[model samples]
Target: MCLCCFLDDGPGSLREGCRRREPLWIVFEVSGTINLVSQLSVSSYKTIDGRGQRIKVAGKGLRLKECEHVIVCNLEFEGGRGHDIDGIQIKPNSRHIWIDRCSLRDYDDGLIDITRQSTDITVSRCYFAQHDKTMLIGADASHVGDRCIRVTIHHCFFNGTRQRHPRLRFGKVHLYNNYTRNWGIYAICASVEAQIYSQCNIYEAGQKKKTFEFYTEKAADREGSSSGFIRSEGDVLLKGAQPCLLQGVGENCVFRPSEYYPTWTLESPLDSLKDILQICTGWQAVPRPAEMLIVA
Candidate 1:
């Protein structure tokens, strides 16, 4: 089943009439801005596909609060502003999600936040630019339930951002074949027992900022196990950037490989990431004809 959010020449409201929110496809028609008045709460078993047209969202962005089997593809989330607003927020036990081929800007607070026990999420082939604090996985240290947050961030382009390409916490994450350039503070942050496995990622940092940093409150304690650790396996590190390991979990920590994530579509990198992000990231536009067509 499918429902169409047809629009006129100007802006349209996503909540004006689109109500049956579950087990259907919401196909957007026409190209304009959908000025979101509030957080667009997505329902389960639904796919909001924004393909073939140029659509923009203002104010608040999409919020997947405890929803399952959702796919948001080929949309542009730009110029979102508010208190702690994100381009996409996957929260509170949501699972089996895929976010692909979307262009995201600063959007004020951040780009995407996957937190609160959300597992089996894939944020792949997306373009993130003109933003600071790009992505955040796992809610916080206090939310120990975030240990179940398993995420895969692959083949995404993070360019000209300040930090938090993702700052993680207490989750098993797989990051592979991504591109990052001109970061402000840090690229990947580890906090609160989070384990990050970075492979074949290109990390380029500026003069002031560091490439990667791991934060643990127990650094002073130096006890049995550290809270956060970043295991760098054959990644491209440039410009005085170094992967800071936690106290106890140094370069010899247990290898938590990419096997933790379930099966999904992935492109394996054969050494060079020269063109992996060219056609994968951002809004994938369909080409138009050179000449016009006349109808009788």
Candidate 2:
């Protein structure tokens, strides 16, 4: 139903609606910003759909902890402050999530973090700008449980984000048809047994031209030779973006998206692809009902 609460803290609030046990398709009737006092913890089987109305969530962020079957679409997340606070965090056994067409920026920590055995996620058509530590897949080297993480990030725009276009620890990540530009340190990182498949993506560098960075960390499970692996196919690097030196990491075999899903939209990394991402990604305006009907 609709979140008619413009204040965002009432009984008919977005927080209360998300706390409900039953599945809900939560939409917004009001067009305004919600300054969350704390982290908005979402329940299982919920869809926070923000179409037709421009809804911005700031101050705090969303925490998807130990939940499943969530879809966050067409929302704007900005100015998340505090220690270890992320714009959107999916962790600790959360699965089957799709974060699509959202704009996230200026977070104290990561914009989006999927870690701690979270899997079956797809982040598509989202825009990330003016943030640092952008998106992180796995938590760290010590968290070996993150080896089960499998994420697909496609058709997203990473605009001038400072690092971690998604730095992972140990996981299988699929990066396809995405655009990342003007990163401060590095564009994509694979650390400690992570497998990344970069297919038909564009990486444009501005001042600092380092595109790929790899690090070897000791995982809790592994004994020796702990390093990440990435296989790039048909990716475009521009503006003096340096190519990755460590091309062959793990036996020249990285997991491909075609092995799992049957089909997906694919495009060549052309210069015009930058225009498509800037124009089409992030929140969009659509038609919706004028009246608010909150589900009980």
Candidate 3:
């Protein structure tokens, strides 16, 4: 079912309409702005598809307060100069959620934040610019334990005007092919048992201070192939500059140069080793054991 409404009419009207149906889809087609003085909470199985009409939610976009199966797509959230006004926040115990093709900017806390028992989430093809905190996965992790898991972030662009760090805590996160440019301490930081598998990700540092830093008190037991990690000239590693650990069949996978042209194949050890050397000067290349190269 499809329900379209104007924000000027009032959120109470939208709330009443949502109560009538259990798990319905709402579409907003108005090409204007709406001021939400308070937070907007969505019920379970509710999908808000904006259809590129620019439904500017003024307050916090959708606070999923213990609600599950929520989908927010193609929407733009404007926080309107407020602190802690996150674009979309999935509260504790929220599960099986998807946020795609959304543009979130200009807030104190973050563009999209998931915390407190949220799991199995996918955030793809979103844009975040000019915010204090761009994206945070499981900020309030102390209370939530290791509840946030299986988070997949792909094809997203994050450009921040202020110096802020994008952090992930105590969860298994997969960050793939995302473009991050300008601002902040670390493009990504994981603490505790949070294992991050990142690949083909580009980190373009703005002409400010540093580029990236990742730290964990206990050594991070991570596994992945990260080729073509491009950083600005001013990028520096602060602590524990160790090459990302790879396991299983990935142990034998040699790093490859980022081939921009179609017909060029990267040469074996030299080109691949140069790519790794460009990123981390301390990285060492050695012969892989025969058993480690065997793939089942």
Ranking by lDDT: 2, 1, 3
TM-score of 2: 0.95
TM-scores for every candidate against the unseen true structure: 0.83, 0.95, 0.68
**Winning candidate number (lDDT):** 2
The positional error of residue 99 in candidate 1, measured at the CA in angstroms, is 0.6
Clashes of each: 1, 0, 1
Stronger candidate by lDDT (2 vs 3): 2
**Candidate 3 per-residue C-alpha lDDT over 218-269 given as tens digits, one digit per residue, 9 for 90 to 100:** 3224353212121222122222322233322242222221221133222222
Q: What TM-score should be assigned to candidate 1?
A: 0.83
lDDT by residue for model 2 (150-219), tens: 9999999999999998898889999999999999999999999889988899999999998988888898
* Cα deviation of 218, candidate 2, in Å: 0.3
Off by over 4 Å in 1: 1-13, 16-21, 218-226, 243-255, 261-272, 287-296
RMSD for each model, in Å, please? 5.5, 2.1, 14.0
Rank candidates by TM-score, best first.
2, 1, 3
lDDT of 2: 0.89
Better of 1 and 3 by TM-score: 1
